[model samples]
Target: MFKLSSTVSQAPISINDSSPAAQASTRLIGFGQTCPQQGCGGASTTLKQLDTRINPDNMCSAGFNASTELCVYSTTSQTACYGDNWQRVGTCARR
Candidate 1:
């Protein structure tokens, strides 16, 4: 986890669709993706949350437990790509 310090001032809360108490909360963020031979950076996409409890899909047999594991997928791709600090790359097909 990372922490950031902002220099801007804070504002008061106003309850509405944009409020914190709103029901339809968004899970959008600047997700990391590949940039081919150049590098992977400055890419953004929405994450698809996966629940191992409801749909295990052999994730538990692969040593990923529902209690501690948090699996997600890129909405734009059928397979998920992973890089270990750009040292090694691997791909896991979506089930």
Candidate 2:
């Protein structure tokens, strides 16, 4: 397991026009893709992995293979994998 560290200290939330409830309920989320594995050969057959909701702020790592998909408790757990199309192989919850 890897430990992730946030470069920014605060969660970027828009509060001006939003209601207090809306502001409180809002969360930051993001998504990204990983690189393909070595010796896999050929870009057409590659399978990269993608992480969703990996952090409480909803930041995502690059893509990864389906096999590397594991539960991460911190920002360091985020990793990058390579593949062809983007697909949701599984789901994880914040620890």
Pairs with steric clashes in candidate 1: none
lDDT, each prediction: 0.31, 0.33
How well does candidate 2 match the true structure in TM-score terms?
0.17
Tally clashes: model 1. Answer: 0
Candidate 1 stretches with Cα past 4 Å from truth are 1-6, 9-30, 35-61, 72-76, 83-95
lDDT of 1 at 86: 11
Model 1 poorest ten-residue lDDT run? 84-93
> Candidate 1 residues 54-82, lDDT tens each?
22335335655444432333334433323
lDDT of 2 by residue, 32-88 (tens): 223335444544343434332333222335563334433333223544433222123
RMSD of each: 11.6, 14.9
